[model samples]
Target: MGGLKVLCIAIVLINGQTIGTVAADGPFPDEARRMRSANEFLSPALRAEQADPIRNRGMLWVEQGERLFAQPPPPGGAQSCASCHASPETSMRGVAARLPAVDAESGQLVNLEGRINDCRILRQSLPPLDYETDELLALTAYLTALSIGEPLTVSIDGPASAFYAYGQQLWSERQGQLNVACTQCHDQSVGRKLRGDTISSAVPTGYPAYRLEWQTLGSLHRRLRSCQLGVRAQLFELGSREYLALELYLKSRARRHLIDAPALRR
Candidate 1:
């Protein structure tokens, strides 16, 4: 009799566990199927991190960048970014909303970081900062913060059209040993668990993000390169044309979304 009772309880426990999973991962309601960025999905704790300057690790890097802007290292008699721009809140406001712009000097599309480096070299007579460095990430995060709450607005027409189109193609093209495209994962798997992590929309809005996995801040391009590597695809160099094109395309997709860079991601 005791054995039968134990068996009955086991069955009930198994049924309850199955039901709980089905409830949690059940089919999304029609309204829920409409895609939303991770911003809308942020848990209370995550939201607090974004709101509280002290808790938001990204704020540390932004503050470092702010200090760098006011007192840049001297190389070739370089001047601080603040010398000309003054307070970032005033001088740099809304600047990121118009980025991935065609540089008149290079006739190439340039993101905010590239433009910053361009200024460092041409105006300040300093060498371009290397990609993924602490100072670079800090500065990029700082600039991105200025545009927070502003809508994403990359140029997709005129000279930028060709680059934008190339980016669109790259998104759909299959690569890597798994033969998966970005859309296969980001578009389809969004809001679903993959390898124990929630896949998100490949939005550029909350970039220069502080990823918990990486335990560091990095540019959007850095995140893209990591994904490309994940699928065993050949990686593009940082600031390369391919990456820039893709960045522009990603930003275009999120044009209607608000800028929320330096965001935390699991």
Candidate 2:
């Protein structure tokens, strides 16, 4: 083991007055320890499928996303996402890896999905897309795919620190009838066989991914809810603060791991 991983906290000041406390780096795994992507644990056949765009079922959603990105805003709208962001390959590159960030305006955490909906509602003058909708998943998968190979760098500083702490709490706290904590499975039993499936490190980099069990692409929150159900816990609403905070903590654990969105999972 290397040096202890420490949480870095800072105090915000204004005119020599302490305003608030911020955590620059929440409690994270040791820096010297390498965190592997969930893709590394994939079966050879599924790995091959994930690698080949033509063979990957998740790519279908990506394609739909591309079309949706270029689609014009409804009548009377100012511009489409394409009009503002231009080519996603050029403008949107590496964007996904930095999400679940605190929105400056709302001072609330917003993931990639939340950001997209924000654009639609505020800029495009359209209604927010529903969670888990084909349109939302497609667009999210498309943007995430563009960040393939990019390392996760989600921030957990400032107001986000509180949320990160909550997420950390949730990760370690035992819940549900089974009284299972996320750490017991993801951190302690990684690589172990679980009902025919190998446990992963609970990385968020591979979502909105294709899951054979679901037979379709789904968001990280959806998967989280599934885990809750697996342990006989109550499910939280999609896009809820609890899940968003948990997503932030999960991404922080996967810091520097290359993104594998639109990934295939058994």
Candidate 3:
């Protein structure tokens, strides 16, 4: 009699486990399928607008950044960016689209500005510029404009693999005394409200944006770092290896999402 009771309980437990698994994975799989189907509705022309090309009419920032590029850094330093990069036609050629790539030697991801600053500090022996400064914004505008129509290219390979994995792990891992992952806010419950702001799909293609909240332009890294601070998680150093890794991962996920460089966002 006891053996029969034990067998019955085991059968019930197995059935309950199966039901829970189906309940968890089922809805998400169906929703993913629907999203894939909806993706085909996107238009390339609309995507082009997101690239945020610098028109000659309202593109004073690009020219200003260009001028700054020709000016020498503070104190004493090597020649300006124009010295070796020369002209956008030659040096800046094919550069805009090739950003946010993995660097094997450094085992990190590197965006265009990160690359520029690396050169400025190491080669020129100068201090790196702060994120979202006038100098940084102008320089980014000028560089991105150089590759206006070129497609963005980001890689996830070699040492970048570990960094990418770490970033994705962080994206899903719950944090904050409130206990939430980025996926909870951005992926699962998109279009919801947080502090009266409509939460849209958290895409990164439109980075280096001018945010209404901050009332100024900011880099993608700054945004990520800010989010970390919001969760009370340890903030990564500016232009750190982890930031580069996260940048590559995020940019790759945002591939073909539209390059809204220097975007104006609320």
Best by TM-score: 2
lDDT of 3 by residue, 1-266 (tens): 35633212111010011100111222332322222211122244433332333322113456566667776765688767877777655578557566777655775567878877887898777778777677777787667655543434555566566767877787788877667787787678766667765555455644665565776667778888877887788778877777776776665554443343554455
What is the alpha-carbon lDDT of model 2 when measured against the actual structure?
0.82
State every prediction's TM-score relative to the real structure: 0.84, 0.87, 0.70
Clashing pairs in 2: none
Model 2 worst lDDT run, 10 consecutive residues: 12-21
Q: What TM-score, to 2 decimals, does candidate 1 have?
A: 0.84
**Which one wins by lDDT: 2 or 3?**
2
Residue 106 local lDDT, model 2: 90
Can you give the lDDT of residue 230 in candidate 1? 87
Where's the lowest-lDDT run of ten residues in candidate 3? Answer: 11-20
Error of 3 at 52 (Å): 9.6
Tens digit per residue, CA lDDT, model 1, 130-202: 8889989998988888777666667788999999999989988999987889988878778887766678777
For candidate 1, the clash count comes to 0
Error of 1 at 27 (Å): 30
The candidate 1 region of ten consecutive residues with least summed lDDT is 11-20
| lDDT agreement with native, every candidate | 0.76, 0.82, 0.59
**Residue 62 local lDDT, model 3:** 61
lDDT, residue 154, candidate 3: 54
- Decide which is better by TM-score, 1 or 3: 1
* Selected candidate, larger TM-score, 2 vs 3: 2
